[model samples]
Target: MKVILTETIESLGIIGSEVKVADGYARNYLLPQKKAVLASQANRNMLKQEKARFELQIAKEKAFAQEMAARLEGTSCTIAAKVSDETRLYGSVTERDILNALAEKGIEIEKHMLLLSEPIKNTGTYNIPVRVYADVEPEIIVEVVAE
Candidate 1:
C-alpha cells in the first residue's frame, strides 16, 4: 500500500515522504496510530506545492544567515567568567554563553547555529564556527577572561 508519512519512520523515510508499505502495516499499524495517511492524488499535489513553498522560504533564510555571517567574520566577543584561581574558571563557556555574549555585541545568533565540538573548558582565545548555511561559513573569535 502507498502511504504518506506524517513524521519520520525509523529506517524508512522522513516526513512528507511517500513510501510503500505492506497492506497490513498501513491499515493496521500506521493508520490506527495516525502515523501516516493513505497516499492519494489530492494529498500528493498538496504536498508538492507545500514543499515548493517551504524550499523557497529556506533559501531566503539561508541568504539572510549568510549576510549575517559575513558581518560576524573576524569579530571578537569577550565573556567574563568567575575564576577560582589565576588560571582556571569556575565554570565552562557553553554555546548558550556564546549566544548571549553575541547578543550583547548586537550580533544575535541562535544557539543551534554555533557548530561547536564542545564547550570551552579553559579561558583563552577560541575560534568558533557559526554556520550561516550549508554553503556559507563564518568564524568568530571568543575571548574568555576571568572576572
Candidate 2:
C-alpha cells in the first residue's frame, strides 16, 4: 500500500514522501497512529499544493535573513564595565550585555544566535560573529571599555 508520510520515519522516508508499505502495517500502525494518509489521487494533489506554499514561505524567510545580514555588516556596539587596575573586567561581558547594547541602537537580536567562545574579560576590541541565518554570518565589532 502506498501512503504519504505526515512525518519522518527513519526506516521509511521523510515527511511528504510517498512510500509503499505492507498493507497490514499501513492499516495497523501508520493509519492508526495518524502518521500517514493513503496516497490517493486527491491526497497527492493536496500535498502538491501544500509543498508549493511551503517553498514560497521558505524563500521569503531566506530573503529576510539576507537583508538582516546586510544591515548587520560592519555594525559595532560598545559595552562599558567596571574593571580592575590591570584592565581585567570585574565580571565578564555576556550575550545579554551585547543584546542590550544592540537594542539601544534599535537592532534586535536573539541571544542564542551570538556565537561567543567565552565571555569578554579584558578591555579591548573584539569582533563577534552572529549567525543571522544558516548560510549568513555577519561580524560586528564590540569595544569593551572601562567604566
Candidate 3:
C-alpha cells in the first residue's frame, strides 16, 4: 500500500514522502500512530507543492544570511559591561550580549547561528564565526574593552 508520511520513518521515507509498505504494517502501525496516511491523489499533489515551498523558503533565507554575513565581515562591535579591577568581566559576555551589540550596529543575528568557542571573560579582542551558508562562514570582531 502507498502512504503519505507525516513524519520521518527510519526504514521508509521522510515527511511528506510517499512510499509503499505492507498493508498490515500501514494499518496496524504507521496509520494508527499517525505517522502516515493513505496517499490519495490530492495529498500527493499537496505534498509536492509543500516541498517546493520549503525549498524556496530555505533558498531565500540562505541568501539573506549571506548578505548579512558580508555586512558583518570587517566590522567590529563592542559590548559594555561591568568589570573588576583586573579587567575581568563580572559576568562574561554572552551570545545575547553579542546579538544585542550587533543589533546596535543594525546587524541582526540569531544566537544559535553565532559561533563562539567561549564567552568573553577578560578585556581583549576576539573573533566569532557567523554561519552564512553551509560553505560560507564569516567572522566578526568583538572588542571587549573595560567599562
Best by TM-score: 2
Least accurate 10 contiguous residues by lDDT in model 3: 7-16
TM-score of 2: 0.67
Q: Write the per-residue lDDT of candidate 1 for residues 19-43, one digit (tens) a residue.
A: 9999999999998998888899998
* Model 2 Cα lDDT, one tens digit per residue, 66-91: 99999998899999999987689999
lDDT of 3 by residue, 64-141 (tens): 768877888878998777889668888899898889988988887777777887888988888888866555679999
Ranking by TM-score: 2, 1, 3
Top candidate, metric lDDT? 2
Model 1 accuracy (lDDT, Cα): 0.82
- Residue 9 of model 1, lDDT score: 64
